[model samples]
Target: MDPFEDTLRRLREAFGVGRTRPAEFRAAQLQGLGRFLRDNRQRLQDALAEDLGKSAIESDVSEIIMCQNEVDLALKNLHTWIKDEPTATNLFTKLGSAFIRKEPFGLVLIIAPWNYPLNLTLVPLVGAIAAGNCVVLKPSEISKGTEKVLAELLPQYLDQSCFAVVLGGPQETGRLLEHKFDYILFTGSPRVGKIVMAAAAKHLTPVTLELGGKNPCYVDDNCDPQTVANRVAWYRYFNAGQTCVAPDYVLCSREMQERLLPALQSAITRFYGDDPQNSPSLGRIINQKHFKRLQGLLGCGRVAIGGQSDESARYIAPTVLVDVQETEPVMQEEIFGPILPLLTVSSLDEAIAFINRREKPLALYAFSNNNQVVNQLLDRTSSGSFGGNEGFIYLTLPTLPLGGVGNSGMGRYHGKFSFDTFSHHRACLLSPAGMERLNEIRYPPYSDWSQQLIRWAMSSQSCTLL
Candidate 1:
């Protein structure tokens, strides 16, 4: 059989005619997932370490435990999330009951990235399962150990017919995409995201693209330098700066830079110690290619603090660069490694303009104690989401909808948003028997009197009945 056909057949068999009552079974499945994660925490962490060389704590926080949290949250809130939402009806429809029914998209394909493989895959998986859809998960092959573990454990713990992991590379992904699905959720680089969207377009399937960008963090002069520096340093180097929402670069006034960079340097030293290479908290680049890419960016910008690497280990120290121009490669793209570029701006307007000049980022951050400055920045700039005086914390909150706009990405999914993402808001209008007279005005008729009456009745200012 063809690969596409094989995948489709497997999914169909798993979903049992693609009609499982998601509302009835999602809570139990989520509970099972939570238990599965708790029962096999050590094994999952070990697998992540083997696959990506992630430290135990990083693996736990970024992957396994995160998935466990999502499962627990889904289980706790499934009932409220799954209920049909009642909507306000207009006067014309007052005799009719109007409500929105959240119905599942039949089959969904989730293509997750290598960085935070488990969290990215399972978080969306929770939503798909919660919304009562069959899922075909394609975990990143680069993290083969984690991929293998998930493929093995998922079938055992969950409904095998409703959820299955397909393990392979680009070829496998290509085959999987050949068969049309009701929805596709992909989290990856912008270039790859575009390809996924284009392929999805052929089938007219809806998609949620969580693409990356050069997310910027603005540190205004009025803010406390030490506090901003500490937060910035921690977020910039978190997960070795591999996060899609990690502060890609910083924009601060030249005077603030003098104060901020030194504090940032101190924070980095404090967090990773004098030698970050041996620091347990510091992580390595996922592969040699990424290491080389980050190493190459160091040349484009002047080094402000620690610019070093170990290619064999795929290690790059928490490096900082100053006086970075827009022409620099680091400034040009998403610096998805342990590198932070600091650019000086003369005014907040200049900072806002710089951010506006680029594609809308997935997350935009501003650090200011002044409410007016915060309001101005929020009003002037547009992003997928904004965080005030915080970095990357927006993603930690399960309540907010996380996504991108413009080139950064399209569509969003998190908590209830995820359920909404996989669900089609089907509209139902039930008209009362007495409202049958109202329908006469909408029926086909060519009389001038009928046309005039119809126009008058449909006008916003008029309240005439048919």
Candidate 2:
């Protein structure tokens, strides 16, 4: 039997019914999820450590706390999100009152990636439930330990009929997609995202794809070298540079590169100590496959600061490579690891040109104190999202619509955006009994006089009808 089918069966049996539209039941489920996280916080942290080698602090802050916050935000705003929103009617339809009703898209499928596995899965699930939809969450099998824990724990807290966690690899995922779903949400690499999208197209089901790309960072001469270095080091090395929004490469003037390299070295050492391989703060690559990919990129550029690796433990130190050409493999692909490549250009215009020559990046960062330089970069570059004078902090904001465009991917979800994503905005018109007489002129059989009267009626701004 298909694993998703079996899992869906279990969920249906647990909920004691196949489906339900009770808002009160959804509220209770959200409240239960909040209580589950609060009570089992340590377990979640331990699972993250076993699965991805994330430090206790990183797991607590990024995974557990963020997931809990999403649940809390949804619970607080559910009443408003569920309410009907009245809309203004056009003059032609003035006799009827129009409103948009937010309705759930039946069963939802969420395919989450390995990096930040819990957060990516649970955050979207919060929106799915808040919008009153059933969800079948497929946590990444790459993070087996975390996936096992989720499969065990989620059912304990949520309404099993409404929410379920399915376990398996790609084959299982393919089987799950074979069945129709009301909506699907996927997060991972662009290559795999295409497969998900293709499958979703079969059902004509709407989807939200959050995929990664070669995100770029530009450091201008006017910026403070030390401050820029510190910020870049923090973001690049955070989660071992596995973050999708992490700066993939640096573009700057040759003179600025000379001033920035030493400061970057200082920041890396400060954060991870002399030997990052032994540092407790730095995380290891999730698996050997990723570790080998980073090792291959090191051959493409000269090591500016650190280039150390341990294949056995899946460890790669905070590495910085300089003098990397655009054709180099490191510059070509999305470096989803702790290896930062630096490409020096003579002018800011050259830097912008270099960025424009490639596919649109998921995120862009420009470090400059000059307002003109910042404004120019923002106006010219095409990216899914960007930050000026900062690094990867935009991903932390709950209000922003977080997703990609073009090759990076499509669709966005966060805060109220998620509610809108999982819902179908159905327009409704309410007309009173007496309003039928006014709409008679819009009815079928037409004479020349009636046509003139119809045109006059539409053209007139006054409420009076002819």
Candidate 3:
């Protein structure tokens, strides 16, 4: 028996009946989502703390606020986004009105990751709802607290007919993937992404895979070591360094590496204090599996700072590793924990070569006072997104898109891009029934005079209708 069959059928019926098609219905759904976040803010924060040891501030800033902003953006632009977009016509269709009508894909599946669970789940939900689709949200089972909150509390705020929160692990997810969906947006590793892609292929369903890669951070000698360290440290260790876009490794000259070491130590100490484990600000690894995995990675390179770990607490310190080789395990995989590796490069060209050699990362960072050096790195290498003299601050803006290029993943989403991704842009043309005279030129009676007239009428220069 298919466990998800009944639920999927009910949602499909709801969507087919146009319960989610109206602009008012979409807006109301978005507003309800906003209320869910606002009404249950504390509960959500507490869940995050329980699951990942995130402080209230980190939970609010990284998850709640980001989700709220997306909801607000969708509401502010919902009417504009739903209206038919007028498109320029060629001479071939001068008398007809053509435009793009954005319609929902009927049903959407959003499979979120454990890291920033609320943000990843709800942000995409905001888009799917605003685009007028019945949605199935599969929150990460690893983050049990957040998953419980979503399963128990979230459905109360949404129309149960159209929105659902299904809970399960890998086997259940595999079973769920067997069902067909109009669209699927998954956030996780590339290996799982491939699995999702393959499952989606069975039904010919389109997907948006937000996968991770070894995001490289390049620090040039021209910059302030303290500034780079602060930015890198804050982002790298944020959410216990589980961010997909966080800088996985740093490439810089030996001199800069020397200068950066102390600055990084200062930042770590200042942020988390002399004893980081005791600090309330620092979070822990998600679970024992991840903790053991991160502990194993700690042996990859010579530790320059913070190599401490507590298995019982699932805690790994804000660690920095130096004298690491490209062939080392730390450099080979996406370091999704609080471990940052520093590998020295003699010049800018070497850094670019090193970055280009690897799979294009989801995010790349280049810190330099000189604009040209940053620009050179930007022009030379390719990544999903580039951060210049900063970290992943670009995610805050709705104007920019968040996605990957090659191995990192495919497809873009966030704000308007999110709505577009969930909605299908259907090309439409409306022609007047009385314009049979204008259609006469397209009829098939062979004649030299008519041929020249038709040719001229269909030409680019003949766009003006007579």
Candidate 4:
């Protein structure tokens, strides 16, 4: 007997009965989710801290607040989003009305990552529910604390008849993937993204993959070194640099690199203090495996600042590396740790060329006092998101979509896009059943004169009015 069969069947039945199609039901679920975030704010923060060594402020701002905004946005716009969108009718179809109905995709599966477990799990859930789809959320087991809370408390907030929280690592996920789902939204790495896509392909299931890439940050010679250092350091080190959109490496000139090193060193010290391992603001690695991987990376690039690591605590200081080779292990992979590597480029054109050579990044950052330099980078490259003089702060806005392209990943979601992602836009036409005269041209069989008259009426621009 399949363990998830009963749960999947129950949800599919609920969806079949049209229990989730109404705007009121969607808004209710959104409000329930909003209350869940607000009521359990502290608990969620503690769970995030326990699971990933995230600071309370970091958890609140990035995870809790972002999820809350998604909930709020969905609740506020559900009615507007659910309405049928009227479309222009062709002359032949002028007697009928054409419109698009945003309908649910039935049962949806959401596989969230461990880095920002709650936010990733619930944010997509908010969208799936708002689009009138029942969802099964599988929170990352690596984030045990947050996963526990979601498995237990989250079901109580949302309607259990339609929503479920499944738990497990790879084996269980594999088993779950065997079952057909109407849609799947997965937030993880590209390696696993292939697995999810392959699973979805068996049933021709639609999928949205939010995967990561080595996001590049191009620091130009024109900017204040300290400002660029601070912004880059904060986002890179935020959530211990596990963020998918974090700037993975710095591309700047040798002169700018020299200036950036000192500024970055000062900024790291100011933010995390002399002993970052003991600092409350700093975070630890999620597990020992990741800690060992990060430790191995420390040996590649020459350490420029704060290369310290403690295996027992799974802690790596806000570190920097210089003289990093393009082919070195540190330069080759997405460093999902607090270590920042600076590779010198000869000029702005050279930096752009280097970025163009690699796979299109998930996010790109260009920092400069000159707007043209930033614009040039923006125009020259393709990335999921481009940050000019900023970091991943764009996530705060529900209007903008977050996603990736090419090697990074595909599909986008956030606020309304999330709802639209989980929904199917169905084309609908309505007309009186007995409009025999109006539909005569659409029917077969006619004399030459009748056919000519009908064709003219159908093709004439003046025939727009019925």
Give TM per candidate.
0.93, 0.95, 0.98, 0.96
Candidate 2: RMSD to truth: 2.3
Ranking by TM-score: 3, 4, 2, 1
Better of 1 and 2 by TM-score: 2
Worst 10 residues of 2 by lDDT: 11-20
| lDDT to native, each model | 0.84, 0.85, 0.94, 0.91
lDDT of 1 by residue, 1-466 (tens): 5755765777776566655565667777777778778888888888877756678988887788768777878888888877878876555666777898888888899999988888999899899988988888899988777788888887788776677778888887887787888899999999999889889999999999999998888989998998998998888888888989888888999999999978988899899999999988887788777788888988977898989888988889898898788987888889998899999999999999999999999888899989888888889988888888988776777899889999889999888788889988899898887757777766786578878866766675564332
Best by TM-score: 3
Cα displacement (angstroms), candidate 4, residue 213, comes to 0.6
Task: Output the better candidate (3/4) by lDDT.
Answer: 3
Per-residue lDDT tens digits for candidate 3, residues 176-278, read 9999999999999999999999999999999999999999999999999999999999999999999999999999999999999999999999999999999
Among these predictions, the greatest lDDT belongs to 3
Using TM-score as the yardstick, the better of models 2 and 3 is: 3
Candidate 3, residue 46: how far the Cα is off, in Å: 0.4
lDDT of 4 by residue, 388-413 (tens): 99999999988899999998888899
- The candidate, 1 or 4, that scores higher on lDDT is 4
The list of candidate 3 runs beyond 4 A from truth reads 464-466
Clashes of 1: 1
**Angstrom error at residue 123, model 1:** 0.6
Show model 4 residue runs off by greater than 4 Å.
443-466
Superposed on all Cα atoms, the candidates' RMSDs to the truth, in angstroms, are: 2.5, 2.3, 1.2, 1.9
In model 3, how large is the Cα lDDT of residue 319? 98
